[model samples]
Target: MDSVRTCVACRKRASRTELLRVVVHEGRLVADDRAVLPGRGAWVHPTARCLDRAVSRGSFPRALRVSGKPDAGPIENRLKTLMDN
Candidate 1:
């Protein structure tokens, strides 16, 4: 059977492959494209809406089990690049 995960923002379960993995590194949030990052991670749909929801709801730090707000600039820039291409 395929693995499943819940989106931190939407709180919906989905096939693991259908979601993007995010992790906190150096107190910043980054997309884990390979899903092999070494840390507590959060999964989310790879869309701006989901990303925005996660951010606006302040879910990143909680999902990632970290204190304070983690920088999501990297993820935003990556998403922008993907949209542009």
Candidate 2:
């Protein structure tokens, strides 16, 4: 069986490999390509819709336990890049 991790955006449990790994470092959200980041990490579906839902719903910010709204800039840009290439 695969390991499970709760999505930072959806607050739902999902397979670790099935979700994208995002890490908050230096107070900035960054996409962790290798899924190896020292600080707290957040999970989200690889799909654009999920990422959007996460951002608009405040799930990302709540899951990360950080104040202020997450602009979803990194997630959005990553999804866009994936679709473009």
Q: Which candidate number maximizes TM-score?
A: 1
TM-score of each: 0.93, 0.79
- The candidate 2 region of ten consecutive residues with least summed lDDT is 22-31
Instruction: Write out the backbone clash pairs for model 1.
Output: none
**How close is each model in CA RMSD to the real structure?**
1.0, 2.0
Residues 1-85, model 2: lDDT tens digits: 8889887665789998888887666666678878887866778888887787777787766777888875567767878898789
lDDT (10s digit) by residue, model 1, range 1-85:
8799999989999998889999998977898989999999899998899999999999998888888999999998887786688
RMSD of 1: 1.0
Model 1 lDDT-worst window of ten: 76-85
Q: Give residue 14's lDDT in candidate 1 (0 to 100).
A: 99
